[model samples]
Target: MKGIRFWAFWPVAYQPSSLQASQPPSLFGLIGRRMTKGQRRKLNRIYFMKYCSNCGQPVIHRTPPGDDRPRFCCESCGMVHYLNPKLVVGCIPEMEDRILLCRRAIEPGYGKWTLPAGYLENGESVAAGAKRETLEEARAKVEILTPYALYNICHVNQIYLMFRARLKDKRFGAGAESLEVKLFGENDIPWEEIAFRVIHATLLKYYDDRRLGRFSFHMENISPPNPNPPKTDN
Candidate 1:
């Protein structure tokens, strides 16, 4: 919050108040109402840009000449910065009747069971990233079989790509990012302790495919539940 500043233009009716100085200005009020806290937070993360990366000058949020949506633009350098979703790659390491899982040692969903997956690095292919993450987290070697499931998590701005993979051997151990690594059968999966919703969805689909004796590609959109729903006048 220290580095974040509110520099967006506001309507003449509103004045910058000292009480709300730490928070970003509300844009929804310009159209007549205030947005929910969750909505504003999501919007702020996506659009907030204090300084332009090109010229090290302050940026303004506005639509470019040809673009429909507003972006952080630099007046000094004439640069428009676009924010995009990140790709997360991972694979389910299968060894006949069992698959591998790791207990995370990190903050988000710590101590919970999850597949060997992480953010895809630059200059890395999707399949290669999946294998690298698998080896890094679970210390396991896997051969990617096929692309299994894709999840579009709009709320968090992430695209998860899960792959079906076969374990090269029984040799695997916990890596630095994992508290422990182990294999679990379909029935032995800890349903309640799964890390993220996308991972949970991938596992559910994977087991379903296994039961049918066939594997197929899957795609889904995942979002958080809305706390406030607009009401219509009767």
Candidate 2:
């Protein structure tokens, strides 16, 4: 019985020779896989030598080797490109039975509908940033009721925090960043035309959760659609 079981599970447990083969090569992988230790060190000395990404100045000796990964120092601007994560704040503001939406006047998705969202300013709280963005884009004052989502967008290196908010006053108009602003009920929302994958996904989740008479938050990276990319330069 043990032999029979082992035979039966062998295919499942054992990796095939083809599957065990090395990873498909990339530029970095090929360099890493083929290079000798000395060659790798030479490559590292050439490519990974400390250089300020901000000012393009060499920063070879400043950081201690024990640090493993150290940020470059820029003497000219006193800047460091530490590659910190950016904070993005968004809000789903509701009034009565309708939700607020804005048509962007900025690049990346001009004239497309979206939830009020933007990068968090320095020293601003996530909720404060969300409320501020709502006011800035839609000219509407919002009271944050609860968090709606916390997403990590790795491609852009941003951490997004979304909130469910209540509009203090329904009176709103388009702000400088927005071409138009309006409230839409579930049926009236332009499902097909909504901009920003995160916004669309949040709305769908919102409606789905609403049907169950409950509110739940979601967190995921929703890549931006390229069909109608922002056309600020044009």
Best by TM-score: 1
Go through the candidates in order and give each one's C-alpha lDDT: 0.83, 0.73
lDDT of 1 by residue, 186-212 (tens): 989999999988889999999999899
The CA lDDT at 165 in model 2 is: 96
The lDDT leader among the candidates is: 1
Which RMSD does model 2 reach against the true structure?
15.0
Task: Record all residue pairs in model 2 with backbone atoms less than 3 Å apart, i.e. clashing.
Answer: 108-230
